[model samples]
Target: MTAVRNVHERVIDAPAAAVGALLDRLSAADDPIFPTPAWPRMRLDRPLAVGADGGHGRIRYHVTAYEPGSRVRFDTPPGGGLDGYHELTVAPLGAERCRVRHVLECEVRGAGILQWGLVIRHLHDTMIEEIFDNIERAAAGGVARPVRWSPWVRLLHRLTWARPRAVGTPAEARLIRSSVDRPDYVDAYRVDLLPGLPRDPAAWTGVLRDAFPVLARDDGELLMDVNTAGLTARASILVDDRHVTLSTAVKTDSPRARAYWGVVKLVHPVMARTMLRRAHRALALAAPSAGERAQAQSPAPERS
Candidate 1:
């Protein structure tokens, strides 16, 4: 028997339970996003069940393992030469965000309808990609809202000093304060590519599929990370004034990190200049309110 594997990773704004529930729902339905034709019309019975116990071709496969908000596993038999497992893991990155990984592994038999390497490969890749794509759509509250952390849901976060551990010297304090902005408590950060042409998350996220060749070709993973943690970037309209504050307590004395920082210092000015130019272009297009314009033209406060 030949063996094959395919893996996909993504971060989403919804909770792990939400993603898992959607997957389970899809499995329960025959026409669950497998492209209409092959998706057996939804059967009234347990549609997702398949394998010896589930009634091969009826349910699809046997649920070998199931763990809520953690993982779910299933497999097919050897006769089909496509026995494999699907593992879904949810990692809480922020109070309301989760990182999801969907992985698949299968054994290819020497003789069977799906024995051909090319055919099996295509099936493994495309199907797995579809799984994540569907999950993303579902989690995004497509036509339906996914689970979310209410204000009552206490997220795990703690305040740390500007320095990681060791007390910062006077010089260090000045440098650290100059780069980072004060932390703001709110929903988690969501980092997705800047949407296409118009840069609108709503208008772009839908049509953005074409820009991603991996997804456009229907053969790739849509790795996404969602978090209410400060790490995420917001999905705001370009017209609004957006300010992103990046903060870190510098306690680590790691040699590697220091080395990288050393390199950054060399060209920081050039980078700043480039960013200013970009900002200028954006300001020109959006034209902030008069109040903002006045603030920008005002002189900076003298530092003590």
Candidate 2:
């Protein structure tokens, strides 16, 4: 068995009260810290309190202790090859300055040791620093320099990025479904619509670019014309509450078109899935940070 104890701390040019307020909002629906969109948002089964059970991504833990504006700790469930807890705390450094710190102490055995040294450590460090950056930006006004993901971290993120899954043509994609009667080819791919991603169908036009003209738009679906090589085709992008689907339908009216499609169909699915996955990641990266979203939503101070 190997024991690991990691600590990261940052001093912010803001009052401890201000910094602690940010900590108290962790796991909130409008969480302004903990770095997200780039990483998974922390979640809890209930509100931030004792017994709250949840964690970000594959990591699982539950709240063991909570002090409204000063500290919170989460302990991992037993028998996961990991034992111990992680916590965040805030302390006053001066009248107008404060320090925020995160500590993770755990014992790992077998494969858990190797995983912690190689993967979990790197990711946890980056996440903690990013969380501090958000604290500075939200409570201290701005961060002169923000943490950047190292090449190794970037590679790991890519390796772990979510991919699109093959799915049957959704019945909700009425535009594409009804566009072609007895269509010669059809395929669909879907990816979960992560929080903060745009729900507007127009924002997903990149899924079928190359100047595909929009033929129609339903509530959450955008239908586009993708005809070429004497073929008739329509693509639909559907953005529902839980998912985003990209569906394609094609009609080959002649022998030339049929032959062309036979060769294209083999590669079409691959391309469609790639495009959807790319767009999903791109939108996620471009989405506003939680702090930025909170600031934007905050009402302006009333004037005399």
Candidate 3:
């Protein structure tokens, strides 16, 4: 077994109380840190107190200890080759300065070591630095030089980004469903509409691009005319509270259109899924960070 201990620390030009207040909101709906969108947001089944259960992404851990405005710790369940705890701590450096630190200690054997050294380590380091960046931005006003993702980190992010899954055309997509009677081709792809992503169907029209004219819009769906290549077609982008779906319907008017669609149908699913997934990720990355959103929504100070 190999033991691993990794640490990251940053000094913020803000009072310990201020920085720690941000720490206390770790898994909050409006968390002021944790560097989300670019990465998975930390989540807890309940509030961020001792016994809270949840972790970001695939990691599974539960809160082991909590100290309101000073520190918090989480421990993974036992038995895995990688077993241990990770925690965040804040200490006052002076009247207007504080040090924020994160530490991960674990015991790894066999494949765990390779996974840690080759992949997890790089991702962890990048994520930690980004967290510190958000700390400085939120608590101390701004980061002089925000951390930049390395090529390896960027590659990993792309490879791990969530992809859309195939789904039947939603009945709610009335525009597309009724646009093509006896359609020659139809398909749909869906992905979660994660928090912080846009809900406006207009914003999602990029899935079919501007070339497609807006045919109609319902309460939550945008229908666009995608007629081209001698085929009559329509595309629908549906945005609801829980999911976003992209659906397409095509009608072949003649033998040429049918033959052309036969060849296009082979790659249509892949293309539709790819476009939807790309749009999902693009919107996520463009959204304001959780910290920024929290700060924006914070109440303004009273003028005495």
Give TM-scores for every candidate, taking all chains together and pairing residue i with residue i. Answer: 0.37, 0.87, 0.87
lDDT of 1: 0.38
- Stronger candidate by TM-score (1 vs 3): 3
The regions of model 1 sitting more than 4 angstroms off are: 29-60, 111-116, 141-304
lDDT per residue (tens digit) for residues 13-67 in model 1? 6666655555555433322222211111222234443331342223245666666
C-alpha displacement of 262 in model 3, angstroms? 2.5
Supply candidate 3's per-residue lDDT for 262. 90
RMSD, each candidate, Å?
Answer: 23.7, 3.0, 2.9
Q: How many backbone clashes does candidate 1 have?
A: 16
| TM-score between model 3 and native | 0.87
Per-residue lDDT of 233-291 in model 3, one digit per residue for the tens?
A: 98999988778999999999989998999999998888888888778888888887765
Model 2 regions lying over 4 Å from their true place: 299-304
RMSD of 3: 2.9
lDDT of 2 at 176: 90
Task: Identify the candidate with maximal lDDT.
Answer: 2
Better of 1 and 2 by TM-score: 2
lDDT of 1 at 91: 72
